[model samples]
Target chain A: MADEPRKIAFICSKGNLDMAYPALIMGWAALGNGVDVTIFFTFWGLDLINKARVDHLEIPPVANTSMKMSMMGIPGNLGIPNIMGVLPGMTAFATALMKKKMNELGVPPVREYIQMLADAGAKLYACKMTVDMMGLKKEDFLDGVQDIVTASDFIDMTEGAQIIFI
Target chain B: MPTRTYAGKTVEVNEEGFMLNPADWTKEIAVEIAKEEGIETLTEAHWKVIDFCRQAGLASGKAPTLRTITTGAGVPTKELFTLFPKGPAKKVARIAGLGKPEGCV
Candidate 1:
């Protein structure tokens, strides 16, 4: 076989900003390594590519506290308990802190990041099953998504590729 | 590091290099790289920071500034450190796969 880097596939299932970020991160990592990367957003993970709802993603309480602590630069073992995420103003506090930190670090907001990823040739696909289940129309998704397909189709395409289910 | 069989072949990877024997790079390595840089893992929020950096790197072939990353990550610019105490721009950039950045080595 030629020395070409193998193709990679990412299957994402959740939709919150918390879950959405990982798939995108991993996808870009593969691309960075020069691997041919394709991301298949399934179930709620498809929310990230949804134009109307993409901007509305919020962290669930179950997923917020850890996110809060992590944003504070705390280690996992040292992070705040998940229950504490329900405390008044905690999410806001965490959001504000993270925004400030991002500013200091020079990271861009979501739309720009999505645009950037698209520009880099990251192939994005939506799960047809999820789209039908959600009753979403084709225009409901963002511009970067390449196409929609079944799980079987995704599997077929990912044969021989590094497959990650996020 | 973790190993799995794909198409009757095994690929090895670690934080450092990609190899045939499942090179040892793993989440632990990514976390270690983050921690050594003094970047505390605040929460999923901070991950969004890293996520944004990845998108920027993937989209632009260049690591983005704090403002640009937050914008891309869909969070306000003021709230980044809640997830990355070492600062969003630098820490997330490191985690996003651009280590030491330009001119820092």
Candidate 2:
């Protein structure tokens, strides 16, 4: 009889197209390490799992790069358009770079990573406020999103869990 | 206090212990300062601009132009936009430690 795993949660609050990776990476990492992980997608962070938005998800170098730089010293105002992320070759290049980095570091792709966490019994929740603001219905998100929740519900559920805001 | 060459500028660690002076600094300078402040292990792309900002300063009195920095760093101009959301190159270059390029306020 092994002890139960400790739980962790990633609160994805960044709705920016480029800021989506941290939450996914952290959640996936927790799962890989055998932690019981949960992701609470709130506000713009819900865009990553949004069905309509997911297909169009592009990692615009301009905005994405600026966001990363912001963590270093760059201001958010200097970022470029997320639309530039859609440039066919551009998107591929960015994705390749990120994927390569992740692979080298033994991380999984976003889709597979999320699935792995889910399979390990990690929960994923979408904020009800985001769903409403985006004019989305419960059915609009991916299949694995466990349930819709208010922030309070999420906070309660995440009690005793190490939480990260991405 | 830790010290590092940011965009070729010797940015001294501030009282707050952040690497660069936060008073209107560019993203590039900010990153280097962050590194000096112990945010080591920067991603390659970040290294790219920091390197470029340094190289450009070495070559000329001013920071490289946007085109030059982008070309030098081998990063797309669009990507540079993300690193520096400010309207022009000088602002970012300044923060990067180039001390503001020409034609910048």
**Cα TM-score per model:** 0.55, 0.46
lDDT tens readout by residue for model 2, A1-166: 2565677889888755457777775554454334677899888777767777664555547445443434324666555456765566865566555556655655444555455445445689999888888788879877778889998999899888888888
Cα lDDT of model 2 by residue, B1-105, tens digit:
666566776655544333344333456566655455344545666567767776677577666655456556787644654444323354445445555444211
Off by over 4 Å in 2: A1-4, A15-18, A63-108, B1-105
Residue-wise C-alpha lDDT for candidate 1, range A38-110, written one tens digit per residue: 8898898877888887876665555543453555766555556677777887666665665566547544445
What DockQ class does candidate 1 belong to? incorrect
DockQ of each: 0.03, 0.01
Q: Which stretch of 10 consecutive residues in model 2 chain A shows the poorest summed lDDT?
A: A63-72
Best by TM-score: 1
For the predicted complex of model 2, DockQ is: 0.01
The recovered share of true contacts, given per candidate in order, is: 0.00, 0.00
Model 2 - which docking category?
A: incorrect
